[model samples]
Target chain A: MSFLAAASTNINPGLKAMGYGLSAIGPGIGVGIVFGQGVNAIARQPELTSTIRTNMLLGFAFSEALALIGLVAPFIYTS
Target chain B: MSFLAAASTNINPGLKAMGYGLSAIGPGIGVGIVFGQGVNAIARQPELTSTIRTNMLLGFAFSEALALIGLVAPFIYTS
Candidate 1:
């Protein structure tokens, strides 16, 4: 039990950064999909390009904000 | 050996929450993109607006739920 405890006790400061890094993967894919699909839609219908573009930006903003919050969470909770 | 062991014992609970927070970032961005582009698609193809809108809502809800899951992970795991 002592051996197990000691093994588990080893701290890794990088673990937090690693977690944050892993979290970024999904958002990256999501953002890519949003824009990729939006562009395809716009290409097919140029008339509504502005509207599409506007909504795309808004979506990107909200999602991106969540990521930003995640980035800050460590610091926020620490305080 | 003792010095190394001594350095290893410190653990931060924040590390886990930081992990959960990190997990949220991707889904957040994902939901944003899904909805944003869906709106754009709807604006362009007004006829298919309902279909696109529904799908977007579904996607957003799913991704948002994932983010919520991440939000709760630390509480569940640490306990």
Candidate 2:
């Protein structure tokens, strides 16, 4: 029982990292989609490339923010 | 027996945060797809930009709802 108690504290040092990893999963795919589609959009309408690229970047920023937050959220919850 | 209970109490404080991380994943990708395809649609049919944007936003909201739900879900489970 004492050993169990000792082990409990040490059991999940990597848990925070794992949380960040899981959190990043969504954003990673999301960024890929935004850029992939953005490229396709540009190919379809080269004249609107500027507008399309701007929108794509905006979407990228929003999606990437989630991953960044995930990186920070662990510290927030732990503390 | 008391020590076992004590150990259990101290375990996995970060579990809730991990729950949130897992939950965010699907919505993240979903949102990306919605916006990406929306942008592509707009480029393909520039005249329909307004309609495309409206639909894109609706899709984004629905997908974002899932992640927001995930953020709140851990508390629901814990309490």
TM-score of chain A of each: 0.75, 0.86
lDDT by residue for model 2 (A34-79), tens: 9999999999999998878877886787777777877776665642
Clash statistics: count for each candidate = 1, 0
Predicted structure with the largest DockQ when compared to the true one: 2
lDDT of 1 by residue, B14-41 (tens): 5764666667766866785677568666
Which portions of model 2 miss their true places by more than 4 Å?
A1-7, B1-9
True-vs-predicted CA distance for residue B75, candidate 2, Å: 1.8
Q: After superposition, how far is residue A28 of candidate 2 from its true place, in Å?
A: 0.3
Measured by lDDT, the strongest candidate is 2
In model 1, state the lDDT of residue B20. 68
TM-score of 2: 0.84
